[model samples]
Target: MTDDPAATFARARAAAGVLFFNDNDQIMLVDPSYKDYRDVPGGYLERGETPRQAAEREVAEELGIHPELGRLLVADWAPSEAEGDKVLFLFDGGTLTKDHLDGIRLDPGELVGFQFHDIAHVHDLTISRLARRLVHAHAAHLDGSTRYLEHGEWI
Candidate 1:
């Protein structure tokens, strides 16, 4: 392998998402119009935008709500065979009040619908890797600590 720094390093794609919860401790998941599985409100980061900014933008674009996101819950480095290396950031979206939930407006172009799911059943609603990430994120939220994961597992 060549020693040139530029040639030796590969650029990894990045995505940011927010984990929203309700008073009942259920996680909010969004149904993307293009995906078969449910996901949190997030998307690929735009050019030059920070992960947090991307998360905020995605929530507004997908759900049409601008709730202030809290601390980082999980930073996962998950590399996929089809998508290549990816770094995902999950942020805390503090419990949503009834008013906030009532104001949700799903963007027809991006998300078809959104629902609250119990933590125990997150695996049934989303992909395995994502389910693991969400579970870790929820644990971090409860303990007020951040987590670093590789392929959705703590390392």
Candidate 2:
């Protein structure tokens, strides 16, 4: 709605999260103390940090575990009334064994606890856009292909 090019240019926000699985194939989710809904382990990028770095850093900060990100799962361009313009990336954290689970020490200020949730029930516990993104990312993980989403829709 602006005549100036600067004003018209979209300043998209970016965030990165990691999707970890258990032996049962359930995905790991965290309960954030600051939010009503559950979320994957991740957060916004710091100054001069890349999405992948932010993904790894956030996991360590929030979960107290450092696991290599296996692959890019979903890179989504999400625009909506609730979230505004943004790009979100979900990375595969591969499968978490018992040792990894035992290592999850939540940062009490950021996270309350972590749980391995069935993929089918994840939708009921998170925001709609995030749920959709996770579903797409999960499928991509199974096929070893990266996925792109626009507002959580495969495109």
Candidate 3:
């Protein structure tokens, strides 16, 4: 993908990510059979659903738990090869226990494995930049610190 920020943002589509946080403060990542790497549980937002509502529905469908999402942690405009002009919304999912995870039911076509990973290690994984920003914003929120908001940064 081109790193030209303007071009990328101009083509970004609308999407959402379900920010799943565990009791240990880690976020949940899903490994899809189609991709070698894992990513946050989410997909393109359906018509008539808000980002927050989409996040809640996605987590419940993928992991079978209704998560209490926090205020918007990260919102970014990104571009994708398969789908362009992707606007990603990432929310802070509160703590979840093993009991909660046990309720998850994987969607065979989209997900294969799942894990609760540390926020710091998130950058090391081969994930979308939007995902990284979401995790960073989440970590910042958790530490009670301020973070720069890149509103319309590329648009």
Candidate 4:
């Protein structure tokens, strides 16, 4: 265990993403400046907002587009290396067009680059395991079924 006091216990965290597809069927993703991982277009929720509202706010703040939010794909708990414990929420949104990307106003301090990849290519994003579960759940959600577990079962 580490000596950092912030690592004491898990913290409840909320995030969202728009799984928009383009005409070519690629999902939109962004590379954050603060991390080397490519993640979905949303961030941690603010103090007074619901997860859905946070998703809308994050998408607009980071990408400058209003994402059409969708079904609750994955809502589960996971551990955070820095924040200790965290609860994650991943939503479902349909595919978007290149025009949406072209019109985006990115937050320079947070996002560095962006890309759209095929659903099958989502594994290349190099994000958190929770994200991987969300991606898998997205596919499962699209297939009209999702079988992910709660916090304890997540590894």
Candidate 5:
């Protein structure tokens, strides 16, 4: 039997991020220095890395804080026009204690700024698909369960 690399290769790209909240029920979002839209702290997964690992690592690289990420909040399948097919993962970053905030040291070259906002502002602050994804993720976090989404819609 012969193994075909074409059939075994990854068809979709994967990325992971974390959803952090505050006591007042706000979502933390970051403004990337290179992108126009605001987004959560994360990046694409490295080879052989799991989603959870990627989330934890990305947060540390971008925010300069090593937060304990919990179970996944959502795994979304979103295909972008520019990126083709992709699978996005979101993990629970839990509520930020004062220490978490105090520890933040944004990488100026990658992230310009970051802020917390009411859930309602997600639509206005992020890209359309990500806005939907975050809205669902925030809700899932409050409910203590993970969500399965397709381009941000509950599936």
Candidate 6:
């Protein structure tokens, strides 16, 4: 143990994202320029920002849209060798109207494009852990509940 109690704790990186669905119940995913796979509209939480605020800010910065986000859907504790430990939060973006969809303006510096995909194909498009998180987040949204997951699986 360390002399200072705070030094004994691990500092996990945290990120916040939103789950958006279209009228067809398809999930909206963004192709990030920095990553090989698609992801939801969100990014890491800045210092002095709440998870929800980070989510909202990321959406505006990445997509240039300001849709109201709903309740928390899923929170996952995922540890990665490359990224160290991480805590991820997913919020409900509700169903996007045509107008909301039309207003999307992708930030070319961060994202390439955005697409809507069938929920069944999520695993094919992203990493397994992220796919699991999306699946559980969608279920939580449908049932109006929240979920806690470890590495994207319920304990």
How far residue 77's Cα lies from its native spot in candidate 5, in Å, is 0.4
Question: What does candidate 6's lDDT look like per residue over 75-146, in tens digits?
Answer: 999989999999999999999988988899999999999999999999999999999999999899889899
lDDT of each: 0.95, 0.91, 0.69, 0.69, 0.92, 0.95
TM-score of each: 0.96, 0.93, 0.76, 0.77, 0.93, 0.97
Candidate 1: regions farther than 4 A off: 1-3
Residues 1-155 of candidate 3: C-alpha lDDT, one tens digit per residue: 77776764464456666666777777778888787877877777788888888888887776667757777666775555666556777776667766777777898877888888787787676465645565566665687542443432322
* 1 against 2, candidate with superior lDDT: 1
- How far off is residue 8 in model 6, in Å? 1.3
Location of the lowest summed lDDT over 10 successive residues in candidate 1: 1-10
Root-mean-square deviation of candidate 3:
6.0
Cα lDDT of model 5 by residue, 1-155, tens digit: 44876876658999999989888989999999999999999999999999888998899999999978888999999988899889999998989989999999999989999999999988988889999999999989989888999989998
Candidate 4 lDDT (Cα, 0 to 1): 0.69
**85, model 4: CA deviation in Å?**
1.3
Q: What root-mean-square deviation over C-alphas does model 1 reach?
A: 1.0
Evaluated with TM-score, which candidate comes out highest? 6
Cα-based RMSD of the predictions, in order?
1.0, 1.6, 6.0, 4.9, 2.3, 0.8
lDDT of candidate 4 over 1-155, digit per residue (tens): 89898987545666655555667756777888987777777778889888888878888888888857777666667666777656666667666656776788889988988877766766566655745665666565678654454652433
Q: lDDT, candidate 5, residue 100?
A: 91
How far out, in Å, is residue 42 in model 1? 0.3
Clashing pairs in model 5, backbone N/Cα/C closer than 3 A:
none
